[model samples]
Target: MTNAHHLQNNKPQDIAINDDWFDVLKISDYLFAISEPRHYEHTVVYLLLGSDRAILIDTGCGIGNLRRVVEQLTSFPITVVNTHTHLDHLGSNHQFSEIMMFDHPRSRDLSSNGASRDLLHWELHREELVIPPWPRDFHIAESALPPFKVSRWLKHDDVLEIADIRFRVLHTPGEAPDHMCLLDQTHRILFSGDILLNGPVWSHLDGGDVGELRDSYERLMRRVNEFDVVMPSHNTPCQNKDLLPLELAASNDVLSGKAQPQVGTDLWGRRYNKYDFGRISILSKYPQ
Candidate 1:
């Protein structure tokens, strides 16, 4: 569990992005981490190539044309599956025709609901930002996440065999109700969308449930020994597998009232209690 493998705070200074809007990191011959570091979200999408087809774990923020970049890398039939339909995760969903998603009300609602400028005001302000500027033609106010259709409805324990890789879907609902974690049994890698990350784990949204997340983490802890690495959606690309227990502990602390959280507000003006774990943080809305 050394710090050398993970990228902390979305600061990927070592990995060169080749002057593109997205920072591309070749995790392996079959896997790629496409990160949008310029935006405050610091979202990272995984591009996985299998023998028969390719599966994109999540589409980055729709600031740039991600489909074109993905086309440049592989010619395999691409199936875009969302970890969760957050503005940042599925912004570019319209760009692809074939998409797989969880059969949930939120996922269905988000499909037609375009991106909200109100929710994205923090990045739109672009003042005192750490990352670089947006694309030349990019305008935040005018931009909207276009609606797209989901091709397939993914369920828990569904086995997806792409080329040589076999992924088992785990229904993990903490960050979002329909959040999923794809376990690549062949490679021993976990594609954790917003379920896990190196930075603050946001569980303060409308349907974000800390109790549900605590249960999910406990389930994940049971299989922690199976995965070698965790690829989260934001901030970091590769995280040590040992961090799984820490996440479980963080969730437990929140449930048991062991970790005292400080009151804070997120960028979206949502009131929440920020719980700080040693390696990571969790932002959860105080129960009403």
Candidate 2:
């Protein structure tokens, strides 16, 4: 992965938030990577600015005031877009009003009912996973994700025009049924959700399908040349496009049974076969 070209310190000193819970890295004049580095998930959300509006792609774990941090960054109207409805990604969705999500049953269910407290127990209670100095207002025991209304349901290939910039939505399910990636052809960037990350990609969860995950990688590989940089949602923020083929190869190996996997258990105590591939790994359910 190449080093991120962060904005200069003098660029906008007034926009910087004094909070330590979130690490905001300026990737470009119009893009910012907002992340919760203190948590185990290291969930990274992105903010893309345009002439008329700004798009916040996925809200990181609701451990802090993301809305306040975002409001300090841009003055344009904001739109929240969930790459998928995973709790870690949409934790702060309720904090935003103009929200957009991919039209899927899982997305609808989670959006309406909200995630239960049980779903967050692993992250909240795991003392070993948390770093020191959590946000003063964040109560681990009482924190729970709230339901948010989706203002628009997006479809595959739909073009989102935020004034001068545009993002083409690609429905790339596998990490979740509602998983999607945004492709900015003009900017040469791919906002890959959980599908392609620097660490282990989980396809062993309840709503995930290893087979479908492999297919999604194949679909992205077909148009790999379209984007030069990959802005993943977890672990690393900005990565070279070279990581795409590596992930695709790992997915293919897992499906073909050519890769040997080690047994592992998640926070929920469900067993999964973890296939390690150096920088990237694939976690899938054991074959019956």
**Tens digits of per-residue lDDT for model 2 on 88-193?**
8898898999999999999999889988887765654355667877688778888888788999999988998766777789999877889999987667688999
- Write candidate 1's Cα lDDT for 89-197 as tens digits: 8878888888988878888887867556665445333444436566766676676676788888889889887667877888999888889898887777888888778
Off by over 4 Å in 1: 1-19, 113-132
Provide the global lDDT of candidate 2 against the true structure: 0.84
C-alpha TM-scores of all predictions: 0.88, 0.91
- List per-prediction Cα lDDT, in the order shown: 0.79, 0.84
The TM-score that candidate 1 achieves is: 0.88
Q: Give the TM-score of candidate 2.
A: 0.91
User: After aligning candidate 2 to the native by TM-score, how far in Å is the CA of 150 from where it should be?
Assistant: 0.6
Best by lDDT: 2
- Number of the predicted model whose TM-score against the real structure is largest: 2
Model 1 per-residue lDDT at 38: 79
Stretches of candidate 2 off by over 4 Å are 1-16, 123-128
